[model samples]
Target: MDKVFLVAVGIGILSRIIMLNTDQRQYPAQPNILLSQLVLAFVASSLGALLVPALRDRAYTSITFLSLAAEQFRQVRENRRDSLQNLEDIQLVKRGEAFIEEIARTYEIRNYMCIITSLSTIGLYYLIIEELKIAKNTSLMISSIIGLALTLILKKLLKRESIGDIADVEIVKISFVDECIMKVGDLKGITNIGLKSDRERYLSRGIGIEIIPKDKDYTNAGILFDSGQRQTIVYNLYSRLGLYREHDEPAFVPLPRRNPKKESLIIAFIPMEKDEQKIIEAVKSCPVLASAKGKNLSLENYKIGKKGSV
Candidate 1:
């Protein structure tokens, strides 16, 4: 599209130059007829240029959709293989799991339209130049070349921008309740966690544990009457805890105040059977889940009614 627009501008400049240099008196006196032909040629060329890009953009979108479909099929095949092999794979699989809504914000569809429109205008300019038979002026040819160059650059830039958007989509955040009870099922991250207003809603509804960083730390301290006593007490507590015992610490701990600001991505799965090892392995394998070095609450912890399932 951009290329077409540039072509139009180039042609327009060349046409203007030709008009300035050539004597209208030397040609047939039907000035109005010649003028109309030039105008029609310019319009048609510009429109054609724009239409090509628009169609191409649509084609790209279609390809993206097909690619997504193919990925889904691959996932289905993997699931079947795991099932027949009695492999411990997670049961639940979420369709379109890789797609994130943020991608739409980064990949501006309007850019495609702009490119198409510009190219169309360029095409019009080219047509006008050819129709006028003003071969002496080189401005039209030069401009057309410039337009083509600009279009190629614009395409590269747009593609780079699109790649960034794809990266953002792959890193979307997901939140979910972390449960202590083990169960076999697919779990996905929540888009939002209403910690203040809906904290109770999450708690009363069922398992309230949310996935959290594995490196999270909490400690209890007691004040002693003397500094020496306090120091001794702290030392004793630290020395008494064994390394193995520390490694076996529970995934969740009580907090003085709820802070739901955690970094994680959403994961969705389909559960086919009840197998704890398989479920845990699946969760661990999920891109969102695997990316975070944290313990997650299983879906079993949430006590939402059957009717409230997402």
Candidate 2:
């Protein structure tokens, strides 16, 4: 039982580490943040590993510890949210409330993943050893395999739908309307710039993109029109290609607007690298946030209801 517990805890920690991916987003990049996550992983794993043995011993009181773990995970979500919110003032492109909440919820859910992996591993070991009467060493090997396989499956399940999944992104030209108002592609009335210098910089260096939703019923259009989703897309692009503007330069800030009639989204911004392909790719790669997922209004029932109402 002791050996089984150790193996379960080790597998749980490994699962957490596997899921703690640091990409271009660079979240959990700081050493302290990384260390804190690992420590919580350890705690979550240990708690999970103890559950099988405690129940076998009829220690029902041990279940209370799981409740404590839930409380701790909730606190982790709050802490993550507070930390990100505090950094908002300093960020050139702020992550909106929807993005922040999504990130916090993700961190909380990951700790629970640790618990689940650990529990599954230890529970399997007991089943093989006590019921099937398998050899201890063989049971350990089989349980470890199962735990790691489950982790990989969960990782695949966690893969999010990117903007590319729902829309087609095209590189467009940044043009001016009436000299001062900037237009992305042919979609006009995006923003107004008073300074000629700003206008010149924009025309010379800015990248414009048009995102056209593929869904004929306009489900993807609804997603693109969300204010929070648009902000998240801008933030993803800014983070990847880097923004050309500074804190004081409001004229250069990236702006995204929707063409409601066409069911498309447009944005123009000056990138630090000035790579049009990179900008397009970044926009396509932006994850469609959970909070901003479009409703299935295209359902036959909904369409019938709309027609009836009209």
The local distance difference test score of each candidate is: 0.31, 0.84
lDDT of 2 at 23: 24
For model 1, residues 1-310, the per-residue Cα lDDT tens digits are: 3544545544433332233222121112256634643453344334434444445456544345334534543453444344323421221211121111112211222223233334544544455566765542353455466655554554454332111111111212223455322211123333233343233332332222222223222110011112222222222222222111122222211111122233211222212232334333332222221112123234323222223323
Poorly placed runs, candidate 2 (over 4 Å): 22-28, 296-310
Q: State the TM-score for model 1.
A: 0.22
lDDT (Cα, tens digit) per residue for candidate 2, span 222-308: 788888899999998888888888899999888888876566898887888988788888888888888877464654232211333
Superposed by TM-score, candidate 1 places the C-alpha of residue 3 at a distance from the truth, in angstroms, of 16
Q: Tell me, by lDDT, which candidate is best.
A: 2
Q: How do all models score by TM-score?
A: 0.22, 0.92
Candidate that would win on TM-score: 2
What is candidate 1's CA lDDT for residue 115? 32
User: Clashes in model 2: which pairs?
Assistant: none
